[model samples]
Target: MDGAVIGLIGTVVGAVSGVLGTLITIRLGGAEQRRTQNDQSERQGRSSAYSALVTACSRTYRVGYAAHATLQAEGHQQSPNDAETLEEFRSAVEEALEAVSVVKLHGPNGIACAADNLASAMSGWRSEVELLADGRGDDQRASEAIELYEELEDRFIALGRETLSGVPARP
Candidate 1:
């Protein structure tokens, strides 16, 4: 073959190879971008879910205290020492724990575990609240319950601070 013809063939092959390589690189880059976008979307979803959990926990706490206050004013005359009232208050604490437990910012963030512990603690305190609510006015027992709840509340506050960096913990 003529030298010019051979040179022309070589140039065409090099040009075709470059075009193919560019197309392959573009495709790969597009695929990578899609994966990153998906990952970001997933993180956003998890974040949203975590926020809702905190809200639920706050709701539980608010409702429990509200109920206690309302019942006290109404003078329903149910012995605070009664099992039902104790159970209800304990449940409210549990709900608060549930919300705080949404702190899944890390593995075994222990929100659920802490909440379970708080519920157990509330059960112990319930007896005193029961007396107080019943209008029996067991000062010591109520004081003990308050002290215990304060500790649990502190734990929740710490967790809230750690898990929700940008958001403030609910009052």
Candidate 2:
């Protein structure tokens, strides 16, 4: 009887150990899967945000450039039909602002700051164009605004590429 009881005890211990090991493995696997899923979701979000910002900036730049060229050609002669062109430019600026806001929400601080600088440059450029349309501003201010906008746009694109590539951002 003593031997039989010892044998039963050994069997029970083996079963419990096996069960515990399996449970631990399953739990660990589930945790790892969750972590992978979360990482993928984060990457997708960042990608989407970066794409939106880039597209918005490109569209805005195109529209703004056209408006600037038109204004330059007009040269201190405000036409009655200029209102339509100015309105289109304003709409483009608003769209770019909206995109910048999204970038700020999803991107890191450095990228967001670059976006902000770009937006500010856009505003300055728009103001310069408006002044030109009113026959009150010189070409120098408009040129300066364009240069600043280009610089900021380059910075923003660099930061965005670094972010998407998983590279550490530069100071």
Candidate 3:
């Protein structure tokens, strides 16, 4: 073979290899960017869900505490017109449930479970309060409900913190 022909073949081979390498690098970089964007979007979604759940839980707790305090002050007396207060409590519970639904959709399984447990505890406490007002429940039961609700709330908060901490800080 001629020396010039051999050189021409070598140059063509080098150029093809360079082009393939560039194409592969670009494809891989695009994939990496997509993965990064997906991670960021997921983190943001979880963070927003966590915030919403926490806020709803806090509001529910406040309303429950107020109702419980009022009952305590009344010494569990039978009031003929407690409908308004009951309705307010129910509204707060509904809000919490809605927020927890969001958490279940956006958060990890563990966090979702924790939020569910907390909501259940809150509901139990509410029922216990109703029973107390009707003079059908004992102080012991109400106290137990309160303790369970508090413990679940603490667990939920801890789970939220763990979930948030695992998320990387945004630039």
Candidate 4:
């Protein structure tokens, strides 16, 4: 081939190679960006769900403690407002249950387990409060239930913090 024809062929090949390289780079960069955004969104969701679960647990614990205190003060007698108090406690428990489900959905397994433990502890505390109000339980039982619930709640909080900080969950 003549020099001009050879030079033309070389230029065309070089141009095609540059275009392909640019296209591939753009495509890979876009994919990486999308992956990063998805990771960030999921992290935010988990954070919000964990926070809600903790708040619900706190409310339930407070209500249970109050009910226990009221029963203690009245010598286990069912007061006129005992029904109302029990109803309020039940509502708090229900809210906590819903929050647990959310945490389970957004969980890395370990956090879900912690949330489940806390919910169970809260339920047990409620049962103790009921027994005390009905004169079937003593102060010690109520106190023990409260202590267990508090411990489980603390565990959940710690696990949630670790999970949010990108730590792998402990079995």
Q: Best candidate, TM-score-wise? A: 4
Q: Please list all clashing residue pairs in model 3, or write none if there are none.
A: none
Give candidate 3 misplaced runs (Cα > 4 Å): 74-81, 167-171
Q: What is the lDDT of candidate 2?
A: 0.84
Q: Give the clash count for each candidate.
A: 6, 0, 0, 0
Point out the worst 10-residue segment of candidate 4 by lDDT.
Answer: 71-80
| RMSD versus native structure for model 1 | 5.9
Put down candidate 1 lDDT per residue, 25-103, tens digits, no spaces.
9999999999999977755654555565545545544554544454455446664345565566667666654554454
> Which structure among the candidates has the greatest lDDT?
4
Q: Which lDDT values do the candidates have, in the order given?
A: 0.59, 0.84, 0.82, 0.89
Candidate 3 backbone overlaps, count: 0
User: Candidate 4 on 1-171: residue-level lDDT in tens?
Assistant: 999999999999999999999999999999999999999999999999999998988788788778878988844567779988988998999999999999999988998999989888888888888887777887898889899999999899889989999675465
lDDT string for model 2 (64-137, tens) is 78778877874336777667777787888888889889889986888889889989998898888778777787
Kindly report which residue stretches of model 1 are placed more than 4 angstroms away from their true locations once superposed. 68-76, 79-171
Candidate 2 collision pairs: none
lDDT, candidate 4, at 148:
94
**TM-score comparison, 2 vs 4, better candidate:** 4
Model 4, runs deviating above 4 Å? 74-76, 167-171
Q: Write the per-residue lDDT of candidate 3 for residues 12-67, one digit (tens) a residue.
A: 99999999999999999999999999999998998888888778878877887777
TM-score of 2: 0.87
